[model samples]
Every structure is written in C-alpha cells, then in structure tokens.
Target: MPTSKETSKTATFGVKNIGGINSTEISISPGVTVLTGKNATNRTSFLQAIMAVMGSDRASLKADADEGHVKLDLGDETYTRTLTQAGDTVRAEGDPYLDDPEVADLFAFLLETNEARQAVARGDDLREIIMRPVDTDSIKREIRRLEERKDDIDAELSTIESRQRDLTDLEQRRNSLREEIGEKREELAAKEEEIDQSSRDIEEGRKEQEQFEQKLKELQSTRSSLESIRNKIESQEASISSLKQERNQIQNEIDELPEVPAGDRDQIDAEIDQLRSERQALNSEISNLQSLIQYNEQRLEEEDYEIAQTLAEDTEGGPSDTVTDQLLDDDEGIVCWTCGSNVDRKQIEDTVSRLQDLRRDKAQKRSELKSKIDDIKSEKRAIEEKRNRRQQATRRLEKVEAELDERDSKITALKQERKELTETVETLETEVKELESEDFEGILSLHKEANQLEFEIDSLESDLESVTQEIEEIEELVAQEDTLRDQREQVEDELADKRTKIDQIEADSVEEFNEHMDAILEILEYGNLERIWIERVEKSVREGRKKVERTKFELHIVRTTENGAAYEDTIDHLSESEREVTGLIFALAGYLVHDLHRGVPFMLLDSLEAIDSDRIATLTDYFSDYVEYLVVALLPEDAQALDDSFDRVTSI
Candidate 1:
C-alpha cells in the first residue's frame, strides 16, 4: 500500500444519491482540476459527495429515494458513507475528517462551512479559530497565570486605597468654605434689616386697605342686585315674544288639516284575503279534476282497445262460438248488462255508448273547474288593487293626524310659557325698585386706595423669597465642600495608579501569542491585513460585578501604505476578494500548523463567486503547488482561465 501522499495523486468519488445526483463517478487526478458545470448539474453535489465520504455530515441526499450513498476510492483503500431509509438513517464507515486535527482545520477553513465564514468577520473568533490548529496550550496556560496574578495585584491595590483614602485638597476646600460662610452671613443680616422696615410700612397699609375693602363690598352688593333685575326683565320679554309666535303656529296648523273621504279599509282587506283563499281552492279543485279526467280517459281508451280485440276475435272465430262467450249465465236477471230478456246486438252497443257519454261528462266538468280557477285569479287581482288604495289613504290620514297632534302640543306649551313670563316680569320689577336708591361715588375712591397697597405688598414678598433661597444655598455649599474635595483627590490618585499598571503588562505573554499570529498572516501574504491584531482594553461598569462588552478584545485590521501604516478600521472597507483571501489565509495557516496527515487530504471552497476572475485564477495556480489533491468548483469562465495549472478537468 502506498502512503497518503502517493495515493492522493488520483482520487475518485462514486455516488448513488437519493437526491440531486444520479449514479456517477468523478475523478480528481493530481493538481488543480475544476468540476465545472452550470449550477446544480451535480457539481456542488459531487463536491458534497466527496465531503461525505471523508466523514463530513453535510450530505443532503436526494429527496424521497430509497437510499443515498457515497464512496471515496483512493487506489489503496476506499471510504464509504451511506444514508439509508430515505436519508432519514445515516450510516458512515471510515474515519471522519475531523478526527485529523489538520483535516479538521482544513474542514473549518472551507468557505462553505459556517465556522470559517463567522471567524473571518469577527476578530476574536478569527483569533481563536486560527489558533485552534496551532499547538499553543502551554503558552495559553502561562498567559492565564499571568493575568490571574495581575488581577490579584489590582484587587489588593483597590482594597488598600479604599481603606486609606487620600484627601489632599480637603484643607484648601475647608478654608474656602469658611470665607463663603462669612459673606453669606453679612448678606443675611442686610436682608433682615430690609424686611423689618418693609414690615412696619405693610402694617400701616393693611389697616387702610381693610376699611376700603369693607366700603367696596357694600357698593358691589347693590350693583349685583341691579344687574340681576335687568337680566330677568330681558329674559321675560323674550319669553312673551316666543310664546305668541308658537300660539300663532298652532292655529295655522289646525286650520290647514286636509279632509279625506272615509272607507271601510278593514273590510276591503278581508275581501282581498278571501279571494286569495278561493283562488287557491279553485286551483286545488282543478288539479284534482284534471287528474280524474286524465285517469278516466286513459281507462276509456283501454276499454275501447279491449272491445276492438273482442271484435277481432269474433271476426276470426265461428259466429256461434263468439256469441256463446258473450252471453250471461243461465240464471241471470232479465235486464242483464242493460239488455232486455231477448238479448240483441243493439243493447250491447248501448252499454258501450253509455261509457262513452260518461267519459265526455268528466272532461266537461274538468273544463268548468279550469274556468272557475281563472275567474278567482282575476278577482284576487281586483281586490288587491282596492286594498292598496285603501292602505295609501290610511297612511295619508295618519300623517295628517300626527301633524294636528304636534300643532295642538305646541299651543298648550306656548300658553304655559306665557303664564311663566308674566310671573317673572312681576318679580323683576319688584327687585329693581329696591336697588334704585344707592350712592357709588364713595366706593370708587376706596378701590383706588386698595390697589396701591397691593403693589407695595407684592414687592416685599418677592424680596423675602430671594433672601431665603440665598441663605439655603450658602449653607449647602459649606456642608458639601470638604466631601467633594476628598472624592476628587482619591479618584485622581487611583486613575494614575491604573495607568502605571496598564504600562507594565504591554510586553506580556498574550502579546507574544499575537506576534506568532502576525507572522502567520505575513506568511500567507494577506496584503489587506498586514499588521492585523487584537487589542485588550479596560471597560467601564456602574460599580457592580464586572460585565464586559460582547468581547474583551477589539479586532483591528491595519493596512500599510507609503506614507505610514494606514489603518483599515472596519470590515466594511475590505472588498469581497480581500475578505475571502483573509479567511483563506487563516485556514491555510491553520492547515500548516497542524501538519497534513489525513488520507488524500484536499481543500474545498464553494465561495469564489465574490472574487474577480483574475484573482480566482491566480489563487487557483498559487494553491495548486502546495497540495497534492486540490478540487475546485468554478463557473465556466473562471475554469477556462485555469489553463495548465489544472492537471485534468471535467464538467458535470
């Protein structure tokens, strides 16, 4: 058996799928070979077929087929993956690609894989994923130990600083507060002197204001009573006018009611209903008579047929035999079957004639019943017309009656309102009589005096409020000045201490691990991300248990230009090719870190759609030399540019 390196030269994947693929075998032999086809011609499905045989669980078998299966044939040995029970049952034999760390890292690198796409966009995720393929457990443990030690130092410093808090500015703040207190004391004394003078002036003003207010009150009472009497007189006049107008309307309505000729509407309605009942009875009788006529006529026809059959028998038979069959029994009555004692041919014919007459009478009676039904129908129509006219007259009368009732109601309401107006007018006249005898000159003079005192009192109250607020502010400042000064000094000292500790940890083991990743990117020649690195920084909290932002480290992508090292700060600025190349470089670096060891190890990528054709060709040529088995799926145009870089190529 050859080693994996030799066996990897030519590989074939055979698949019998329950889904997109028919039974087919595809071979990828030595060097770059593109599986080219229009979309969904089993191109991607074939690639997935290879993945499935290599222990990739991403085999989407054909829908509703008995069983789906994939086989990987390396000249030395074969690996198989079968999905049974219509793809519901998955059975795999041979090693999963993930069992090999290098293979696992390569699997993670596949752009079709979710893990690779996620790691490429986020810095922390990329850092962990790239490092996953590298042997860095010892370095990681050392970094963890150092971080724990640094945390301990920081914790001890916090406890000591909290216990022995420094307040260097306290003395200065205390002296300043003393000066402020003295100034506020002088301000308070000046305000008190002004308040005392205003109090004496207000006392004299209050006594004068009281006498004026009492005089104004008595005069206002007289004015109120006069206004009320005037308002009532106006309301009463309006009421009298409205009442007269309503009474005239009621008289007009009573004079205009129209007279209608009286008719017994109920009797007409009863007659119309009776006509309808009679019509229904006529129809029922006609239907029964028609049925009887039809039945009897059918029986008459059958009897005539029987008599013709008897006549035919008589014509064929001997006369004597025929006559004997027609005769009655020996002990019969004298007028048997309407025949006399000496039975003759005429008597037999009369029996047949009587039946014919009876049938004719039945038909005549049916015709009579039909005529009666039509007459009843006509009567019903006439009665319905009369009933409609009576209904219209009744509606008109009801409308006229409703109008008369409304007019009568208005007349009664108007009379009641006129009586109320007369009473109101009498009460108003009595009230106006008493208010006609008061003097208002003295009240006018009192109002002017009260207004002047009110102005002076408002000015005094405003000044008192200002002085009271000033005193309260001065006392608060004196109380808080020392505490604020102590807090400021302590915060400044702690911030300075933290800065020193931050400087001390810059050259630690974490930075060294980052240096190794930087070298990997350089090897992969990630042009867009030359100095890309993750940074650790402190975060702020609201004095609670520490809660970090989504991640502790920030992913910084830096691009170097001629001027200096330019920064590509955000993922958005990178082009599609640049971004994909960054992920590709990471996966390749991981592949080398773990060292390739799986049988027929190869790389798979389904995401060349975003990269330009030139870049795709260049990357294809570049990757071909590094791996023995490189199977790429590309569109026709991109595969055309592949040229001699591919050993052999086939389309689906």
Candidate 2:
C-alpha cells in the first residue's frame, strides 16, 4: 500500500472481456515493470489494453463476448475504451489521457507494426530507426556505411603510398650500390697487369686488398652504429621538447577554466516543466478554437449559398404569401431548406443581419482567443528564456567541470610521459656525450691508419694500372663486363618492376566504380517497400579537394523531385517510373527539410493523375520513404497498390 499522494501518482488499468481476458486491475509503476504469464493466459490481452490507453486500437472482444472494455486511470483522471464487434470499431470515452491527437501516433509505428516487431525480434539494432541525425535514420546509416567503404579505399591508397615511398628509397640505394660496385671493379681491372708482373707483388697486393676490405667493413659498421645511437639521442630530445610544450599548453588551458558552484537545478526544472504543461494546454485550446472557427465559417458559407439558391427557386415557383402560408401550416415551422433550419418570415428578413451578427461574434471570439494565446505565448516565452538561461549556466558549469576533469587526467598523463621522456633523454645524452669524448682519440687513430693504408693501396693501384695497360689481356675485362651487364640487368628489372607497381597504385586512385559498381546488386538487402532507405555510393575520391579529375559524385542515394524523374545517377537500376517516384521523394525531402526531426511527411495526391495503375504498388512503397500520411485518391480495383506490403487497406 502507498500513501494517497504516492498512489495518485501511478497509472492504474482495468480490462474486461478483451480477447481471452475476463476482469483484472493493475497498478502500473512509474518505470519499466514486466508482467509475466504463460501463453494463452491473457498477458498479451492485458498488454493490448495498456497500448489501447495510449491510443492503439489493438484490442478486440472475445468471440463469445459481445463487448470489451479497457479502463485506464492516469493519476486523478480516468479513461475508458469500449470495443464492440457489431460496429467493428474502438470507441473511446472519458479522459483517455490523450488530449492531443499527435500523441496517438507515437506508439503506432512501434507497437502495431508487425514488420517492425519482427525486425526487433530478430535482434536487429534499433538505432537505425531511432536516431535523429536525419528524419530517416536509414539515410544516416547509409551515409555511415558509405563512409566505411570510403575508409577501406583510403586504407588501400595508404598502403600504395607507403609502398611508393619504399620503392623510391630502394631505387636510390640500388643506384648507389651499382655505382660503388662499378668503381671497385674498375680499380681492380686497372691493377690486373701490375699484379701479373711479379708473383710476389701479386700475392702481396692480394693480401693488402683483403685487409683493406676487412677494415672498410669494420669502419662502415662502426659508422652505422654511431649514426643509429645519435638518431636515438636526437629522437628522445625532440620528444622531451614536444612533451614540455604540450604540458605547458595544457596547464595554461586548465588555469583559464573558471570554478563552478552548485545551483537549484531540480526546482528550476520543475518550474519549467509546469510552465511547459500550461503552454501545451493553451496551445490545445487555441487549436480547438481555430478548428471551430474554420468549421463554422465553412458551414455558414454553405448555408447562406444554399438558402439564397433555395429562396430563388421557391420565389420563382410560388408567390411569397403562398410560401408563407404553407410554412405556417407545417408543424415543424417554416422549413428553411437552404440552411436546414426552422425559420419564419421574420427570421428570413433578418437572415443577413443574423449572419452578420454571428460572423461578428465568431470574429470577436477568435480575436479574444488570439489575444489569450498571445498572453500564454508571452508567459511561455519568458519561462523558456529563463529555463534556457539556467540550462546555459548548467551547461557552462558542466563544461568547466568536464574541462577540469580532462585537465587533471591529461596533466597526470603529461607528467608521467614527461618523466619517462626526461629519463630517456638524460640517459641517451650521457651515453652520447661520453661516447663522443672517449671516441675522439680512437677515431683520430683510425683515420691516420686508414690514410696510410689508402696511400699504400693507391701506389699499388697506380703501378698496377700502368702495368695492366701494357701487358694485361682484353679477355679478362670482357668477361668482367659480361658479369656486370647481367648484374645490371637484374637490378634494372627490380627497379623497373617497383616503379611499375607504384604507377599502378597511383592509377588505382582513379578507379571510380571499383567499389560502388555493385551497389544495385547490394540494394536488395532489406525490407519490402512501405518503409525503406535506399543507399547508393556512386564514387569516392580520396584526394583532398583540388583541381583533380574525379567523378562528380562521392556518395549518391535515390532522390526524387516533385512529379519529376527520380534520379540524377548515371547508372540507375530502377525503372523509369521508379526513378520518377524517387525524384518525388527528393522533392519532398527538400520541402520538409525544416521539419526533418518531426518524422515522415504528410502528402496529398489528387489521384496521382498522370501515373498509371500498373506501377501503383511500386509508387506506394517508394512513397513510404518520404510520406508518413499519404492521402492518394485512387481506384482500388485499378490501383491494387494496397499489396501485402501495406499494413492496412480500407475501401469505401
């Protein structure tokens, strides 16, 4: 049991003779609560009653019962919906809690739609249907999918770019290696004759060349190691510098943020909510009054026209005195045929005056309504502005709070990173400094030894070159040239192949239809046509916006213009009529751009006059992509548009 105040806050429900349900009453909690029962135990029936209270006509009486009733108690108000098989209609009475007609549509798309239910039952993600990035979540999802594909292409392009860079570096290294090998071979050839001049000299020169080669390898290795260490030291120093800069920036940002204080958020929210409810009530009243005024004006116009026409006909047929006599004799009084009301001669005489007075009264009432609406609007506006001010303050405070949190987190991260970098920089700098100081003497000694070895080698090579020119045979040089040609051919082939691959990768950038050529084949992945989102990615360009030749479209989807062809695509898979309908959707999307978050549009078609009935079903399905409420006056027998894809089909 709850206190009266707490009890009155809950919604209660009662159901009787609905489907297999007999009589049951339940107090629904404020939040999500489940009702468990075995199949065939009226669980669905009870649930249907709850849906009914929200304006879903999903309930019917049991076959044996003549009538069914669902009663809902929302706080202090109660509403009842009576279901009768005789009339095949749901008649709602009392306070159904739904004063606004708009709310009735809320649960309709979710609760009553079997397709939607099946989709959910299959465990499909509902975000695609619920997100407001666009009125149609499908469109947004399609765009997201297109982005994924574009990213995949970009990944491939990145690989190609990286490979190209590698190829360029390899090509340069290959050229340098060939140059070094060629120079060494030329020097050896030049010394060949001198080596043949004496066996002792030849043997001594061979030993000297071997030793020089060994020392050269050692020197090269030492240099490479030194360079590696220096690069590491430099990299650490750069990282430390960057860390310090970033830390300073973050600290500055943290210092700039203002401190925030607590506010009376709950009270402010309550006031705003109360003001909004009052405004909603005022809006409903104003809408009702406007509707009444419109209806009254139309009725008056029709009444006056009919009365004038009837009076003319009556006057032409009979005298005024005779007509008056006939009216007096009648029990129902003068049958004012025009207005369909009882009126005497006096009433007829004052007909214009009466209409004028009634119009004046209605106009005055409308003015008063407008004035009242203005007052309510002013009040609501003031409340909203204050609420917005508070909300802005709250947002600013939250932003500052979040910034502070981020600042703390980032500061901690920066401090740890800075410490690690500082340690690394210190260690590398010490090693580099010690190595530099200690290696100066060793490097100088090695340089002197290297110069002496080079002087001896040069003298030996010079003597060998002169002797070789005089006595060496051409056969050896010819054989060496052949070997070098084969090696050069092999190197050239590798370099050429790499260059070709790089070119191929660059060419892959222009493959406009490579990924999207199969979009039409892929479009058949989802549902029948009543509601759908069609996506087409025509082409994607990876390059930044520049003066480059690329396909005009990046991502394209089905589009329609009003009564126009549906596609701007060069490759349209749908038929001409389909494209036309799709074009109409584009037109609708453009027209309803302002009301995108309001859900689907309301469209009226005067029989879709130019369209043929053979493609009505297709059009119906296509229309669902754009229109929520479509009023198309078409001959059903001819149309047959209400196919199995449609949820409900009614004929009059």
Candidate 3:
C-alpha cells in the first residue's frame, strides 16, 4: 500500500524522540507515516515505546539492560513514556508510578495480528458506531419495560387467584347457610303444626274438666242426704235408752253402783301414785340435765376466753378492727406469732366466726335445757291435776255410776228397741249403697273426662316437643347465617386487598417503564417514547389440536421528526438507511441510559467498515462532533481512509 501521507489526512497520533531516541530528537507531525524496517530492528519496539509513553497498550516486549523511553503528543496533552522489561513484566512511567504489578500488563493486549491492527487502525469512533446500530439504550430500556410489565402481570395474577379463592369460600358458606335455612324452615313448619295441636289439647282438657266438675257436684249432694239420715237414727236410739234406764232404776232401791270394790279403787290409786312418782323422777332427771348443760356452757365460756386471749396475742400488732372488719380491710396476709408464718386474714376471721357460732350454740343449748325443765314441770302439774280430777270424779262416779248401772238395765231394753231400729237403718243404708253403686252419670262422666284430659295432655306434650325441636333448628340456622355473613365480609376484605395490590403493581410497573423509556429517548434525541409492548401468540388450533403459545416483542418507536412532525414506526420493515439511523439512535440512547444508570463509560464497537466512504465520512464527522471516548475496530484500509478529525489512533 502507498504511504498514508499521499492522502493528506492528518494522523490521529504522533510521537517525538526524547531521552531514549538514537542520538537524535525527531518530532512526529499530524499525518499518516510509514515505518518500513526488518523484523527485530526496533520497529515494533519503537511502537511499544510510543504506546507505553501514551499510557496505552504494552503486551509485547522483552526485558533488556536499558530502559526504552519516548514522548507522545496526544491531541490534548503530552505524555512521556518509559518502560523497562523485568522478566515477563514491564515497568511503565507515564502518569504516576503504576505500582500495581499488573500495570505493566498492557503488553498482553498488544496488536499482534493484522486483524487486531485493522480493528484499531480504523478512525471510526466506537461510541459513535455503537450508537449507530440498534441502540443499546433502547434494548435495555425495552428489557426493563418488559420486566416491569411482567411484574404487573404477576401481581394481577395473584389478585385474580385471591379473588377466586374468596369468592369460592363465600359460595361455599352461602351453600351451607342455605342448607341450614332449609332445615330451619322445615322445623318452623312443624312447630306451627305442633302449636296448633297443643292449643286443641288445651281446649279439650278444659271441656273435660267442666264435665268432671258437674259430676262432682251431683255426687256431693247425694252424700249430704245420706249424712242426714244417719244423724236422725242416732238421736232416736238415745231417746229409747233414756226411757229404758228410768224404768230399770225405779225397780232398784235407789241402786247405787256397788261401791267400786276397795281393791279396785286401791289398784286405781296405785296407778295414779305410780304416775306421780314417774313425773317426779322426770323432773329430777331434767334438773340434773340442766346442771350438766350449765356446766357445758361454763366450759364453752372458758374456751371462748382462751380463744379470745389467743387471738389478742396473735394479732397484737395487726389490724385493730374486729376479725371480719380486718379481713375486709386487709388483703395482705398477717404474720401469725404462734407459728411465725403467714396467716390469711380471712382464715382468722373464719375462725373467729366459728367461735361466735359455738357461743351462740352454747347459749341456744342452755335455753333449750331451760325449756325442757319448764316442760317437765308443766307435765307434772298436769298429772297432779288429773289425779285431783280423778278423786273428784271418783266420788261423783261412785254415786252416778250406781244410778248409771240401774239406767244400764233400762238401757238394755232400750238397746233392744234401738237394735230393731238400727236393723231398719242398716236396711236403708244397704239400699243407699245399692243406689250409689248404680253407676251414676256423674261417675261415668268423671272417668270419661279423666281419660280425655290425659289424652289432651299427651297431645300437648307431643306438640311442645316438636316446637322445641323447631326452635333448635332455627338456632342452628341462625348460627349458620352468621358464619356465612362473616365469611362474605372476609371475602370482600380479601378481594379489596388483592385489588389494592394489583393497582400498586400496575402503578409501579408503569412508572419504571416510563422512567426507563424516557431516559433512552432523551439520549436518542427522540421525543417521549409512548410505550414498549410485548405481544404473545396464544391458542393456535391446527390439525384439530390446540398448541401451546410463545411470546415475541414488537418494538415501537415514537418520536417527533426534525420537522416537528410526530411519527411512529415498527421495527419490522425499514430501509437500510432507516435501519442504520434507527440503530444509531438506539445506541445513543443506550449510552445515555448507561451513563444515567451508572454503567461503564467506555464503548467497544466492531464491524462498521461496510458503510461507503461518503457515509463513513459523514458518520465520523457526526461522532467527532458528538460523543466522548470511542474505541472502534475496522479493516486496515478503512482505518487508512478516515479524515483528519480523529483524536488518537492505536493498532489493536
């Protein structure tokens, strides 16, 4: 190839000899230069020296005794590079002391092949080229957008599932409640029937009771008539006795009852005396019992005194009130002096109360003993009175009884008459009994009425049972309804929560996607990108078989044209030029997005040698005017053809 100088393009890089130049200093100008020399003649070494000086690549070098040094004129600044190979590594001096051992590793990346050389030699800026094709910014933005959409979809799916679950639960509860309601309705119907039957039974019982009452009245009237007959008979018999006694007494010479035999009287007197003696004994026994009871009472009083002393000693430092009052006021337990342990105030109060009960019991027993003594004395007086009455009656009875004996003979004859009358009365009583036995209408009615009442009560009981059963069913149904209502409320709450989550997800996704798209569009010099959407294929039916689905993206570009006309386009069918422009816009967008998002500052580009030279020139001018640092790989020829605007040139 001819020397690059013939093209008159400025060189992107320049070098000048410094301390390590061969006995001379040479300034490299801004133009292409050709270095022709045999291998191992310091040509490659010189290149390394220049790159090392510029703080660029240095991978191919061997250590020698001396340091190779050079100076470089990068368009903006000057750098002095010096290198000394130490075994497999080299030391470089450019910026500061690259003390990191790996600092000398630039040699590993040295351009060793034509491909590597051509890649670096191209003057096309890598940043520009990357910005030239499908914008990395747009791709990244689209990816983020899709991710956000996916998150939203996931949230929506969760909401749907939750709603479904809640709805299903509500439906199940409703079904259960309906079943319970059905049972309750059935029970209510039965209860209504039972109540009606109970009312009927009550009515029947009342009617039967009326019949029994009427029959009972008739029976009572019949019994009264029988009573009157018996009284009359008794009076008539007494009349007959009086007449018979008078006749018999007239015959007896004033017949006094033979004075009760002295022996008989004596025997009676003995019985009376014995009774009096027994009463005397009971009085003495009662007196002794009183004395014993008094002794027990005294003993109880002594016990009371002891208990009082014990209580006073035990509660000396405790509450001053009565035991019960202290218990009411003192919740914290008192210390028992006797046992040096905690004593519940309530327990002490209870003990005191028991002592009072004992006292009352002792008093009650004393009173009871006194009452018994009085009763014994009263009984003895009654016995004495009976004895006196017996003595008085003995005198009258001796005289009157004698007369009574004479009257008794008369009474015998009267009794015969009375017997005859009694026989007639017996005959009447038998007839009455026969009349009663005739199965009166009242008796028959009573039996019938009792039977009816019993039947009514039975029916009423059956109806009450049915009503109770119905009430139980209603209660169960009400419980079920309550449960269903609670479940419905819960379902509503769950659905509300799910909806909120879904809404939140949708909002978040939309915001993130918009932010990302805005960032990319700003970098591309395109107006707002409205949206990035993904379309998924679904439900393919072929050969009578349904097939699963897949998804693909359709990139949408929305921007205002240079003329201020709004335009929208799809990625499917674009001219070569349009595609290239679109790609470049996308790449620019990517870099801007990367910077915004804190990505790497450098851009590495490959394969831009296909553009025509005119197009390449325009792109170069555009890149030089726009972005920052760019590293491009290109064909050697393409590199040689770049205009004189490139900042720096280095073979790969």
Candidate 4:
C-alpha cells in the first residue's frame, strides 16, 4: 500500500476519559467521517478524553470510567499515555519522538485552549515554540571592542614612553644649560672682581690727582701773587733808588753849601731818621696786607682743585647727563639733584653776589696796601726835608750836642719798623712756596665706581643666563605636551570609530529580530494583521493611574465594516464565530506541522458551537480531511451537521 500523504492518515492514537467517561477509545483517520447522535450524547466527553491523551491535565472528561488511557501508533512506532484526576503521564516507544523533540512537544502544545495558544504564539519569549541560535556575531564584536581597547591602551603607553624620553632629554639639557650658566657666572664674577680692583686703583689715583691739582692750583695762585708782590717790590726798590739818588744829590749840594753846619747836619740827620721810622711802619702794614691777599688767593686755588677732584671721585659715568652749563643756565632756577628740592634761586644769587663782593674786597685791600706803601714813601721824603731844615738851624745855633741825642732815638724806631717789614715779606714768600706744592684726589674714586658697576653687571648676567636656560627647557616641555595632546586626539578618534561600528552591529541585531518576526507572520498566515508585536510591558498607564501590566505579546488587526470603513481592533473584540475560525485555523496549522514531523497524528478541540449548526459537521469533516488526526468536542446536533463519511466515533 502507498504511504498516506494526508496529514491525518494511518495514525492510531488513544484517548481516556477521566471525568464523565472512565474508559473509551476514539479512532482518527483522514477523509470526512461524521459523528452523529442526540443532544445529550458524550461527544464533548470524548474530546476531553483526547486532550488527556495529548498531555493536558486541565481537561476533565465527564465519564464514569474507572481510569483513562491513550494509545498511539505510527507505522514505525507506537506511543501511549494515561491521565487521572491528579495529572497526566506520557510514554512512547518505537516512534520518531527521538528524531524530533518538537514533535512530542507539539502534542502537548495542541491540547491548549485557543487563548493559551494565542498567548504562547504571540509571546516575546518563544523558546517553547521556536529555536534560537547563539549570537556569534555579537560575541565577535564584543571581542573586537576589547581588542581595540587594548590597542588604544598600548598606543597610549607608547605615547607616554615617548613623552618620558622627551622629558628625560629635556631635563638633561636643562641641567647642562644650568651648568654652563654656572661656569659663565663664575667667570663673570672673576671679571667683576678684576674690574672692582681696577676701580679701587682708579679711585686712589683720582684722590692723588685731586690732591695734586689742588696743590698745583694753590702753587699757581701763590706764584702769581708772589710775582705781583715781587713786581711791587721791584717798583719800591726803584723808588728807593731814585729817592737815594735824589737824597745823595741833595747831600752833595748841602756839602757844598756849609762846612760850619755840622751841628745843623746832625740835627737834620736826626729828623730824617724819625721820618724813615714812620715810613718803615707804613710799609710794614702794607706788606702784611699784601701777604694776606696772596695767601687767600692761594687758598682759593687749592679749594678749586680739591672740589674738582672730589667731584671726579664721585662721578658716575664719565660725566653726569646733568651738566654744569645746564645748572648755571638755570642758576636763577637751579634745583638740587640729590633731593629733587629747589635750590632757592635767591640763595644762589646771593652766594654769587657774595663771591663778587669778596673779590672786590680783595681788590680794595690791594689798593689800600698800595696806598699805604705810597704814604710811607711820602713820609720818607718829608723826613729827609725835615732833616735838612734841622741840620741848617742847629749848625747855626751851636746846639749840635742836643741834635746828636735826638738822632739816636730816631734811629732806634727806624730799626724796629725795618724789622716788621722784613718779617711780613718773609711770611708772604713762605705761603707762596706752600701753595706751589703739587698734590691731587680723583683716581681712586673712579676705580671704586668701576668696581661696583662691574660687580652689578656680573650678577645680572648670571641671572639672565639662568633664566634663558629655564625658558628653553620650558619650551621643550611645551612641545612634548603638544605632542601628547595630538596623540590623545588620534586615540579618541579611533575609539569613536570603534563605537560607531558597535552601534552598527547593534542595529543589525535589531534588523534580525524584525526579520524573525516576519517569518513568524508568514507561518501564521497573519499578513492581514495591522500590527503584530511582542514586548514585556513595563507599565500600562490608563485612566490617570499607572497600572503595571506585563503582556508578552499582542496581535492587532483592522476590521472592515459593510460600509467599507476599516477600524483597528484586537483579537478579544472579535465575534465568537470569527474567534472560532481563527482558533480552528491556528489548530489546523499546528496539527499539520506536528503530523509532518512524525508526531502523534492528533488534535484535541473544544467549544465549537460558535459556528452554526449547519456548519458544524462541515467543519468537522473539513478537519478530518485536512488533518491526520483530530478530537473535537461537540453536542450531537453539531455532530449531525457533519456529513455521513465520519465513522467509528465512540460515544461516552
């Protein structure tokens, strides 16, 4: 015999009644075979019997049978199971259950109610109804991400190492530069020391020079005054010679005039001696004044040189930017350099005026000294004439004895006056010699200034070199810092690329889920559904209260009205007849899959009255022809609606 191709052909499965029927058997076959009986017949009881055989323990048959059992046979295998008030037990032997676990599993799945079937089919977790493979691509992608992370870390480590090397090099360079700077500083210090010594020597030299200049000025001033005095002395000597010649001429004339005038000559000599004494005293006073004037002029020259040397010693850089000319130009408004205070122009003017007055006083004193000298000469002349007159009178009177005594007294006074004059001239000459001496003061001062400046320059240069070296080192570090930043940016960019790849992989995984959903829709012939989706509902917000509802899946469809308007509706809102048709279709598909896979060729169904009585038997016949095996629950009227082809239906 040819192997039956029909899904319901050549399979024997057994059923047991646990509630209404204690024991019963219903045979399943292909082709239309109707079950016909009265209204109260146990056709529904028989359907529950089949459910008990399939592994559903919830189905309770109304039979008085003491026990329930189901036996099934495929050509190459047989299976059996039993049910009781407590539970169901399944056993199979010599069947293809080992080849397909899905087949054995389908038997249990088919026994569920339409609601339960819908729930399982639409569930997000469909492990019970489907097989899923491990996501190898995701694993590989994760591994790739880890590997990329490791690579990035390795790159960072390299960058850090390079930076460390750069730092080391920079540090070494910094140290070297510092060492060089130190050596330069030491050299500069030595140079500064040399310059200091030179400056000290210069300062001492300046001091000596100042002394020399001062002494030389004094000597020059004294020499000038002495020469002037010597000129005056020459003039005095000439006058004295002229007076002597005149006196000699007068004496010759007198000698020619009278020999008898010895007494008179004696008297005249006495009076002339007295006049000479007075002239000598005046000459002495004049000589003293000249000496004082000469001394003062010498002192002024010494002071000028001393002040010059002192200024040079204190001089800063050759000459101050401030000039004597500027000071003199603004003498009327001169200010002190050191204190920024005004010099009081009146004070300076007064000082200048006083200096001029002192010069004028010196000139006056010289004139007065000259006048005194002239007066002394005049006295000498007068004395000579008086001597002449006295000699003439005495010689005539014979009082020559008295004239001799008077002449001796006059001689004594003249000798005293001559002594004072000689003393004054000698003092003036000594002062001139002293002023002419050479001494000076500015060399040492310049040396000291140079030394101080050199020291400061050395110190500043040392600090500058050190700072420059430090700046160079800092610049190197800055370069290294820039490199590090660039490396970090590159690493970040790489990481971003990796993250983008990861996102792409995740998107692909979601695509796979969508593809799997399409496949499920195709298998269910549910292409007309408005939307079908699966989710684990976290929360359902309704009527202003958050009601948490965990629904695994949902199927939504749009129904069309007779007026041709379409409206979205859920399976729960469908008419009973439509639900029945949907449920039947679902059962038919499941049974076909199970049968094709060599599972027990059986279906267990209940609650079929939603279809009209006329359509009832037709549905039964359709199931019987469409499937290899089926067990349907119905009233006798429903069974009568089936055609007469259905046979061997066991009544409870």
The residue-level lDDT of candidate 2 at 108 comes to 26
> Candidate 4: where is the Cα deviation over 4 Å?
1-17, 38-40, 54-67, 73-78, 83-553, 589-597, 614-626, 648-650
When sorted by lDDT, best at the front, the candidate numbers are 1, 4, 2, 3
The per-model lDDT (C-alpha) reads: 0.51, 0.43, 0.41, 0.47
lDDT of 4: 0.47
Query: What lDDT tens digits, residue by residue, belong to model 3 across residues 127-155?
Result: 22222222333344445545555555455
TM-score of 2: 0.23
Please write out the lDDT profile of model 1 over residues 407-450, one tens digit for every residue.
55654655565465556545543443333222322334333233
Task: State how far residue 436 of model 4 sits from its true place (Å).
Answer: 99
**Cα misplacement distance, residue 339 of candidate 1 (Å):** 94
- RMSD (Cα, Å) of model 2: 23.8
As for TM-score, the candidate ahead, 1 or 3, is 1
Q: Between candidates 3 and 4, name the one with more favorable lDDT.
A: 4
Worst 10 residues of 2 by lDDT: 107-116
| lDDT (Cα, tens digit) per residue for candidate 4, span 533-645 | 23323346454466665322233456556666767876666556545544444434444433332444455555566667665554565555544555565556676655555
Candidate 2 steric clashes: 10
How many backbone overlaps does candidate 1 show? 2
RMSD of candidates 1 onward, in order: 40.6, 23.8, 51.4, 63.0
TM-score-based ranking: 1, 4, 2, 3
The candidate, 1 or 2, that scores higher on TM-score is 1
- Please say which candidate is ahead in lDDT: 1 or 4: 1
